[model samples]
Target: MQITLPRIGTVAAWRQQVRKLAAAGIDPQAVIWSVGAAAPDLFATAAPAPGVATPLMLSLEAVDGIEMALLHSDPERFSRAHALVLRLSKREVRWGDRSDPLMRRLLDQQKAVGREIHKMHGFVRFREVSPPGANRRAFAAWFEPDHPVLEAAAPFFARRFGDMDWLIATPTLTARCEAGEMRIEETEARQPPPKDAAEELWRVYFASIFNPARLMVKAMKSHMPQKYWKNLPEADLIPDLIRSAETRVRAMHDPSAPAPETLPGGRMRKKLR
Candidate 1:
């Protein structure tokens, strides 16, 4: 039977549908899962009658892994996850077994989602957007994610910035937090909020703390991919900073350079070293 799912199916939807198919003893191959509004084959079987659901149990780790993997942007993710779920339910398959190709793929995708979540948390910069009459401070940020991860990533921001009102907008969805309440709404691609004074301050702070002596472009890019640079305020400074790194480090080590001193007013002055 062919099962047609929404273009962007949620974890819950996948789980529910999988459960029904599994209960009916339907093999993954027997059911063709087409996502979005793709036309079904003319000879496709109609939706099968749902069987009495057998108690489906899986390790919490397996559940979490598959859930996050579903958020991946890969079009084949649904079929892969479904196959894995079927295997786990019917047999005593160890989800952590790397020898199994399906399990390995799931593991890799899980890691991808984890990395994306970490990057979103670290790189999302909020710019103040309060108007003149606003009693509470407001901020907003624009992010572009590789997966449908905003829902999973929202809780961290909610807890960390509990006292503030903010919105994190992305191409697929927007996560809005206000008055300690969190909400995710479907949204189209949006223009980034206007540049604010705070962004400049953050850029200056980032540059000041950057250590040219430790600069490693390859390692840096490995951790912070180039794809994310467009949304990061500090990224614009990276090229110039990298180009001049050798000169900056040389100045730091040059004995001919001035020694910095603290003045009475707490300002620092430089004198020949």
Candidate 2:
């Protein structure tokens, strides 16, 4: 009976199964394997010609009657089946394994991170923040993102501001530069932030806008998940701030807390070494 091998996505795992068949006494010399959506033309003379494939091919045959066959009962049971493929991804090597699960995962991960890194390199915002008349120059910026993406993002800042001092603090990590040297620090810990008129006022504004009459608790949680609530400056506003329309109106009317005035790019800048 002609065996029909199962396929996943576009990967034809026939080559691997064929090798296993060879070692298991299903002599490779006796069986012809060709990869495609359709079966290959069998010459029926024992030795079949190799078919064309996008990826290069490797052939193996049993020298004796003892051949190999796959334990089909468990193809994906080996977790390390993908280990070899992952190593290739890290080295930026692309392998043609239409049927290898690990190779597919490595490609997916590389694509996901490569895009995010490219965006961070282009879009990160930084602000200069050295107090006037200070001996040196300094800068700071704020950003909100879902993951620990700072270490991979530090190189962009170093390249952009090789001579200036600055810091980029996200909810999870902080990248800082001093005297033209840059380093990343993990900030999984939280400290009480300095009391700010903006945060308090934002809370008031938030509570006042919340309307019990129109509230949908399920929808609220869906739109604003628990994970993001703690890190947002606007989160504290949700609980008490949204209680009534009157409070919200008062907050809305309040003047936006004025930002501290600083000379645009203070003239006391150091010449890049």
Candidate 3:
């Protein structure tokens, strides 16, 4: 899908993008549609529903979760014209300055990009790859993101780990970044990933840090839910974490409480854990 910001001549540009896609054998229906709040009256009138391909756009503040998606089932199947269309569209939509109205619009576009990446970052699970003499590490994650951002999301891995090789496969795209280069491919499903012990430790830490007595259950569920629990070790501990809050609070505040267990030097003998 192509995402764009509102520019001075966006209407003409939008028309050109569709035409460009058509010329390259891309079914307009196949592209996921995304756009910006500043789009002209013609396209900025409605919000697209999840999984549906429609014009997605956003204001700067709302950029957190908004996008303009034009869905294409066949990504990476570009011919010469299709590739050229993408190149041309990117050049036209490039940002110039932070202060300019155009730049602000682009920032909104990029924030939508960031939010898209973040959603994948949260949902994509990494699996361990066991091999005898592998130089590059391998992991696997599965996600059915409601939006199309796999093309833009791969770079996040590069930024997070510039020296390693990795593969992030999505239903629509399979991305690999190694030896300072990144690429994407179209693929179907693959094998499930293996587990990691380190991830379990991290999940335990996450669950430990959360104080359940402060729970806003509704708000907490809004950010996370049972469906994602299996992938998150902390999720299992949430119930326990929540139950312990009241007892922990009362123990610390009880006026008649005895002194805490301490060591010889007068330091608390308690483990942070």
lDDT string for model 3 (1-273, tens) is 444623223334555665545445454334544343423445432333323222322234322221222221222212222333333344543323445444454445545556556767775666665366888665556555544567656677778866766677665567777676877766566544566765666565575566645777778876665555666544655665565555556657874544234233222222342
RMSD (CA, Å), candidate 1 to true, equals 4.7
Runs with alpha carbons beyond 4 Å of true place in candidate 2:
1-82, 85-98, 188-273
> Quick one: best TM-score, which candidate?
1
* lDDT tens per residue, model 1, 1-273: 877765444677778888888778666666776655677687667765554444577889889988998878877787888888867866757888889998898889889998999999988999999989987899999999998789889899999998999999998689899998988877665878998888777777777787879999999999889999998887887887777677666668985655444333222344543
TM-score to native of every candidate shown: 0.86, 0.37, 0.52
Ranking of predictions according to lDDT: 1, 3, 2
The per-prediction CA RMSD against the true structure, in angstroms, equals 4.7, 18.4, 12.5
Judging by lDDT against the true structure, name the best candidate.
Answer: 1
Per-model lDDT: 0.80, 0.45, 0.50
lDDT of 2 by residue, 42-104 (tens): 544533344322222222221110111111113331122223322332443336353656555
Worst 10 residues of 1 by lDDT: 259-268
Flag the better candidate by lDDT, 1 or 3.
1
| Model 1: lDDT to the true structure | 0.80
* Model 3 global lDDT (CA atoms, 0 to 1): 0.50
TM-score computed on alpha carbons, candidate 2: 0.37
